[model samples]
Target: MEAYNFETAIKPFFWVASDKTFSVCLNAGTYKPEIFEWRKDEGFEGNGYDWASLAKVFLEEKRPDLAEDIRFDPEADMFCAYSENPDKLKEFITGFKETCENELQIQDLFLKAEID
Candidate 1:
């Protein structure tokens, strides 16, 4: 059986560039019951909570350095890591991609995944 893609046309990722800063925007826009159910045991109430819980585990347990340079905006419903230095933003994007792949089990996550 072929693997199905949860989101393709409108991928859950995007790139934002401005002046000398670059940011990787993680759009967890909306999630259904399965997401809430799957992570309920982890104490995530869904939506922003899901991102927070996942980021906490990924940053604290997986990559600590990336966490320091990242920020989540609840009002905008976006998680963005920006840096004036290209190398710094690149590093953050790499670790963020790993978090989605390893933690979220998004194996086919590529292209617009914010990788250089």
Candidate 2:
């Protein structure tokens, strides 16, 4: 199988909010990067299986403090996070890319019957 390069494959951009909070945005294929308000009407339906769930879990595991800042909008297919510290924001994005790559590997293995 060909290797997928996360750094070259996925690019993340930053948006500074009015309050000066640095927000990171990633476009995963068909998704367009945009700010989304938190939805109180709908509940999370991923149940730890989807990409959003995996990303949240990964962030929580790697950086609990930044995890709470994460937001994913399935309808918009956007993933975003806000951080006051630019360095922390950068770290989160780097970690996020790694998490995505790891998840992708597991998915590939499952599809290829290499894993049960």
* Candidate No. with top lDDT: 1
Candidate 2 error regions (>4 Å) = 1-19, 31-52, 68-75, 103-116
- Model 1 is weakest, by summed lDDT over 10 consecutive residues, at 107-116
Name the regions of candidate 1 deviating beyond 4 angstroms. Answer: 1-11, 29-36, 41-45, 103-116
Write one digit per residue (lDDT tens) for candidate 2, span 76-96. Answer: 344456666766766777776
Residue pairs clashing in model 1 are none
lDDT of 1 by residue, 36-77 (tens): 454455554445545544545555555676666665443335
Residue 98's lDDT within candidate 1 is: 51
Q: What is the TM-score of each candidate against the true structure?
A: 0.53, 0.48
CA-lDDT, candidates in order: 0.50, 0.47
lDDT of 1 at 23: 61
